[model samples]
Target: MKYIKIKRVMDFIFSLILLIVISPIMLCAAVAIKCGGQGPVLFKQERPGKDGVIFTIYKFRTMRLETEKDGHPLSDMERMTRVGMMLRKLSIDELPQLLNILRGNMSFIGPRPLLIQYLERYTPEQMRRHDVTPGISGWAQINGRNGIDWETRFEYDLWYVKNISFLTDLKIFLGTLAVILGTRGVNQSKSQTMEEFGVATKSLKG
Candidate 1:
């Protein structure tokens, strides 16, 4: 239990340091997102954090503002700009989450914060994924990211929740670097995000 306290301190200190160290890159990313399209530089969305609490998650905007081309809605891939794609490829879009970490809304390592809508879909067991603070990169992320199915991802998340430790976190941190550098498991679809969690997948009562 003391490690939880240690992890929070480390999350705060490291997030602060990393933000300062990466400010230049963050600035360029912001500018590029701004000039790349007509939308806001930063994308903000509500996500469920620990205990299913809602919090605003931040990322560099990686999709165009327009939802439709000519009455028909554009697909996510079609709406993605070249610069946005580059940022997503390099994981630059996630850098803004350091602010979330600093604010105690997230961790550097843990189960990832998922969509607000997913709150109701999770079974009682699956909802345990939020027993700890969400992270920028997590066990499910390093293992398969968006490439894996929701059930498997939730399993890995719960595994991490049960086994969180310095060594486990270290492994995830190093593995995250490899995943980013190797561009592994980055997408489950051409949309570059996971498909929505379906109600049909809820096998257990909430």
Candidate 2:
């Protein structure tokens, strides 16, 4: 209990410091997005937080709002602009999420919050991931991130949830830095991001 409180405090303080430190980069990213195309500078989406609570997560817009001939949206890679791709590759697109951390919707280290629509799709074991506040980066992120399968990702999330500690968070933070520097695990195979989970299956045992 005390550790959780301390973690939250650290998360808040570090996030505030980071926001201030990266404000310039964020501004540059916003300008770059505007120059790239016409769309909102920030991409807001609802994601599930601790205990299945919903919250608005913020990220820099890294894809152009493009449509198909029939007016449907194009695929992520297709809609991704040159500047957007650079932002994603450098992880500049995620800088805005520090605001989410400041707002208490996220933490510096925990499981990455997933789409809200995926709430109902989680198996009982997978549901355990929501036991703690979501994070900017976590064990799964450092281990394989989008490079791993969904089941493996959830397994790592659950593991972190069950064994959260200051040391664990520190490791994840350092690992995230390495990943950003190395530019690995930014996207999944053959896709800019991992594909969405359609429906929960009985065979999905987390």
Candidate 3:
């Protein structure tokens, strides 16, 4: 349990320092978002955290609030503004979640939090991901991000839960930084943002 305590301390300290270091960038992103369109600068959504606890996760708004003439939502691709696309491609949209880490709502390394509604869809085995606090950067994200299939993503998440350690967290942190630094691209929409986890699937059946 030493490393677990270390992880929480690191989450608080590093998140605080990084937020201060990156405040300028976050501010610029906010300004750009405002200049781009009419919408909130931050996109806050309810996500499941440790042990299925619901919490509001924050990210920079990376899409426009565009609706059709009839006021229905537009497709993700269609609603994505140019600035938003660039922000996502550079992984800058995730910078705000550093605050979530500092706030104890998330960890620096664990399973990335997913939609609250996906709670009931997970099998008992898959639901094991909630055994640890959710994270901003995780094993699944450093692997293929949204490019991988759902089953594969869940597998990586569960693996992380079972094998978490100081070295594991360090490795994931370095790997995620490599992604943000352009050594590896974190494509948020190679297919799409893995948003279709609402239905129970046979792959998740015990």
Q: What lDDT does the true structure give each of the candidates?
A: 0.89, 0.85, 0.84
Rank candidates by lDDT, best first.
1, 2, 3
Q: Give a tens-digit lDDT track for model 2, residues 24-111.
A: 9899899989988899999999998998988999999988776564876577777778998899888898888888888888998889
In candidate 2, the residue pairs with backbone N, CA or C atoms under 3 Å apart (3 or more residues apart, or in different chains) clash, namely: none
**How well is each residue in 14-127 modelled by candidate 1, as lDDT tens digits?**
999999999999999988877776878999999999988899999999888898987998887888889988887789999999999999999999999988877877788889
The sequence of per-residue lDDT tens digits that candidate 3 reaches over residues 28-108 is 999999999899999999999999989999999987676454766566767778898888878888889998999999987
TM-score of each: 0.95, 0.93, 0.91
The prediction achieving the highest TM-score against the true structure is 1
Between prediction 2 and prediction 3, the one with superior TM-score is 2
Total clashes for model 3: 0
Give lDDT for model 1: 0.89
- What is candidate 2's TM-score against the reference? 0.93
Models ranked on TM-score: 1, 2, 3
Of 1 and 2, which scores higher on lDDT? 1
Give the local distance difference test score of model 3: 0.84
Error of 2 at 81 (Å): 1.2
Model 3 misplaced regions, further than 4 Å: 67-73, 182-191, 198-206
